[model samples]
Target: MKKLVISIVLVNLLAACASQKPHETTAAPAAPVAAAATATAPATATVAAAKTAVDPLNDPTSILAGRSVYYPFDVAAVQDADKPLVQAHAEYLSKNAARNVRLEGNCDERGSNEYNLALGQRRADGVMKMLELGGAKAAQLDSVSYGEEKPKATGHEESSWSQNRRTDLNYAK
Candidate 1:
């Protein structure tokens, strides 16, 4: 009789377990580290998105987009209209210490090659000095004269001359 009763109890327990659904099994709670990471996922994504934004140098909307600073004929001075351009470049250079620039000075087709070369050198040097004074490091700036060899305009008129007398700011690769 005692053996029959034990067999009946074991059968009942087995039947109960077999009838339960698989999803009824209890699960351990999530880990603290995993919970924290899940909570902050959106904030982390936001920070990464902000960092991926474009740099001002490559941005089309920035004032630093202007590369050429035009000057009057035979003048080495930065014109009133172009001063802000130079200032913007200087600010950029100062903020980015690893960046370096080359100032290429050019002249119109009117002058002799020798005279044009010298004038171009003066123009490049003038811009270089201004950048240095505006907070750029001396080591970050270099000046070169292309003179009449690299004229922007080929005409003999004042319009072309005005376009050619300029300093081009080139960033190092």
Candidate 2:
């Protein structure tokens, strides 16, 4: 009878110890632990079930997925319409220090090569400034001008030109 009581006390102590210990990852709803079989085992299986976060950039519904900021003809400033897009990217970059982005500036086919290149640089730089102001580190950003070299649309119409004048936020792998 004494041996039976001691065994029960030992089992209660073991269960208490298991329940009180901290978990590195969140544990799921615990099952009724009927026996002492799992007392000494590491909880790797439970850790594997811990929830993981999906990156906002990869989530199509997030504003961070809107990578391109468009501009009017010969304009270098970011438009009011695209401010939210830039702000979201800026916030994401600020949070994820390991991530880096290249701001690629592109222009329409209406300007001289030198002029277009300079304008594109200004456009890229403008977005870079906004990102920095919004809390992203300068080290996580790079700006470059492609000028008219990388056109999103090849046609000479306003529709095509509108598509071409922009800066693209390209994330590094």
Candidate 3:
């Protein structure tokens, strides 16, 4: 009976540790993948499931699948770490001309509504400009500011603010 109780406590402790750990990624940087995709011929989708199930844009292995461009507090510029994500999406957009993407700009819940809206717009525009420079056509991109009104995290701390300050790449069908 003592052994069983000890085993249960050990199991609970292990579960608690596992649940508390943050997600870690060892995936290689996104730039090289984008460059490779640009150099190679478009991959053929042989199976019907392949078409919908394995879209490069949605594929976990593809850099194009990354959609968020996180920003620093009070800053609208894209971080160096996230630029590759933007670049990959740019390459994909240039290759697939029919697809349209909306950049939704957001801000943390700390500033005046007017100020946050402007900052969010700047964030979206910054990404839009980068995409254009990366070969995406102006017609394929659009930007909208949600500002403090739409936050990814609800908490009023840095952790939450970090998530809230981002430009989301929302693809249209």
TM-score on alpha carbons, each prediction: 0.69, 0.70, 0.75
Error of 1 at 85 (Å): 0.6
By lDDT: ranked, best first: 3, 2, 1
Better of 2 and 3 by TM-score: 3
Q: Per-candidate RMSD vs. true structure?
A: 32.8, 25.5, 9.6
Candidate 2 local distance difference test against the native: 0.75
User: Residues 1-173, candidate 3, lDDT per residue (tens digit)?
Assistant: 97787668656644553443222111364454744555554544444455566667777767676677876669998866677778778888998899999999999987899999999999999999999999999999999999999888898655577678889999997
lDDT by candidate, in order shown: 0.75, 0.75, 0.78
Q: What stretches of model 1 exceed 4 Å from their correct place?
A: 1-52
Each candidate structure's count of clashing pairs: 0, 0, 0
On lDDT, the leading prediction is: 3
Where is model 1 poorest over a 10-residue stretch in terms of lDDT? 21-30
Q: Pick the candidate with the highest TM-score.
A: 3
TM-score ranking of the models = 3, 2, 1
In Å, residue 72's CA in model 3 sits off its true spot by 1.0
